[model samples]
Target: MRVAVLGGGLQGCCVALALAERGIDAAIFDRNDQLLSRAAVANEGKIHLGYMYANDVSYSTARMMMQGALAFAPFFARHLGSSQDSLSISRPAAYVVHRDSQRSPGQVSQYLKTVHGLIREASGRRGDAYFGRDLTTAPRMWSEAEREAEFDPQIALAAFDTAEVAIDPAALAGAVRSRIEADPRIDVRLQHQVTSVDDADGFDVVLQARCGILRERFDHVVNALWDGRFAINETRGLRPDRPWLHRLKYGVSFRLPRGTSLPPSATFVSGPFGEVVSYADGLTYLTWYPVCLQGISTDVTPPEWPTYPAEPLRSDLLQGTLKAMAQFVPCLRGLDPGGLEEVTVKGGVIVAWGETDIYDPRSELHRRFEIGVTSRGRFHSVDPGKLTMAPYFAEVCAGRILQDIVR
Candidate 1:
């Protein structure tokens, strides 16, 4: 049977690859020439050691992430045609550093213990099939002076040795795409814009572009639009309740000098404006810059507030970040400003379900099934973390599609 996957983003490509692996013919379609390109470009290339959301209680998200990480391993290895050593799957010892006065060391310890226990429990239930073994242990506290000596001079107390992995997000996605395209069963059409979908005599998917209207028929179709839910609503003429549309804030990456000594591991620093900062490929990246003012999403992105752009690099945000960095590692202060090369500002409404849910599981499932049901289809969506999760998503979607068709 022929299947049409909508969107050439990671999700769509993954779903298509899975379908192809099952000996099913699938066609991937996208309206954007730069599918997954935007999200891919903004990536810091971290494989994520599963600690980013250690505090999250969402069992489903946690479970998916764990399973997804493992699934990604083989998929990436095969797709990239590279050994584990070449992939930069750096299993670094992660840390969460906070000021001693801001939060008690005991509270921080408790938090780590709770998260570690949860990870262990979750891994145990999943057996060796998931990331149970790969999960990192909770961090241990370091004295203020010791942290200063080891890191930089500004560090107070350091919680070191948590599990985390890092990678080049763009390279990873490109590798996956390259591998999938090698298979003749899959056809990736670039510069094709899918404007609408209709169930006429058969499933008709329409494409509108500068060229003209192109049409294709498919037995199944999937919709995976990153932040572009409006396209789906316009195409299907259906308005599904999406509470978590744009509630997330992100940061841009600034390329540091060619020869800057970065920390060996990724660090999560909490201060007046907590941020996730990491240095890779001579670029120091900072994200989660708050745009909220007075506890509300304000016009001004905060912690650094008004001083941004005018002084960009010297802005309050970067200064606070630098201060936090110094607290964790004193050497950061001495790092030459000449080493700072370029800065890219990236802030967007992170998709979420109200303030509580970050992802819509139900909508995701529906979109997957829609693609599976379509013949000769493709789908796309922007996900900086797409490389780590798309493989499993593809496998699951393919299995579901086959099941639906056979039954």
Candidate 2:
């Protein structure tokens, strides 16, 4: 039996690869000529564990993100068909900075305790977390006393190294795409948009390819179409009574002034409404979400598929991003957010399913990288939260799909 995988993003590519690994014939359909150009490629190049999810304790495995982080290394090695001891790793130790208004030294210490729990969750009696002693690159803290002098006197409370790595997105996607494309069982269809899917024997999907429209039937259909998945399903009369939702979150990646001295290891300054992630490629500083005042739209309850212009990091967006950056990094003050060179703005809608209860960081809109099968049982949606964990989600979701097909 053949399976049709929709959307050629990270999830779609991974699902196809996983299915092929089990010897199940699969096809991937996507509209982007450069399949990894969208949200999958354009993102803060983080290999996140629980540092990002420390605030999100509502879930059983609030710090369980380390579970996914652990799985990625081997899976990524296999995806690249590489035998190297490690993949492309940029360890710019992560930081979770706090503002004086919201956090105190005691609170910062408590926060570090939570991170320690995450490390324990990630590795048992191990020095490191993700890459040997490398993953847990020794989480360190600059006490409240240390922070007071370096930061804007009033705003800075405390800061710490979160032991996170940054992987090159384009490289990761290219590796996965190249490796998966070489497999004969996995048919890779680029520049092909899945226009619609309907009930036939299993599912009949219409595609608008570069040449013309094409239709195919499959035993099962998997939708890894990020923000657009819901709309595509809605067209098929598959509405969500209990549905997973998607929203657009924008990010602005910019370069700091030359000779700006920063911590040798510290990266991604994090506070309540301020975040700055230094990416692997270009070493560009990306700020967004709760930090940037205008990252989320006024009302994108159910965000539309982002119709971003060919080159659009609107002036207002850039302005807001710089403001957020200064809130965290005092050194970034007065750096012009303009004069963007090459790729600058990166990000799109992140998905959330089920009931999200927290506000802001742990809020309903928080990002997750997990997979799901629809109630219909035949279709699986790649509802992801983070870039680092997409492969793990695909592995689990692929197993579920294969089990059904073989039975």
Point out the worst 10-residue segment of candidate 1 by lDDT: 365-374
Per-prediction TM-score, please?
Answer: 0.71, 0.81
Clashes of each: 45, 7
Write one digit per residue (lDDT tens) for candidate 1, span 207-251.
776778888887666655444534553566554354333333434
Query: Whole-model Cα lDDT per candidate?
Result: 0.52, 0.63
TM-score of model 1 relative to the true fold?
0.71
Model 2, residue 26: distance off in Å is 1.6
Please list the residue runs of candidate 2 whose C-alpha ends up more than 4 Å from where it truly belongs after superposition: 59-61, 83-88, 100-108, 122-129, 133-138, 144-150, 210-212, 242-245, 254-272, 279-282, 290-312, 334-343, 353-362, 366-371
Q: Give the range of the ten consecutive residues with the poorest summed lDDT in model 2.
A: 292-301
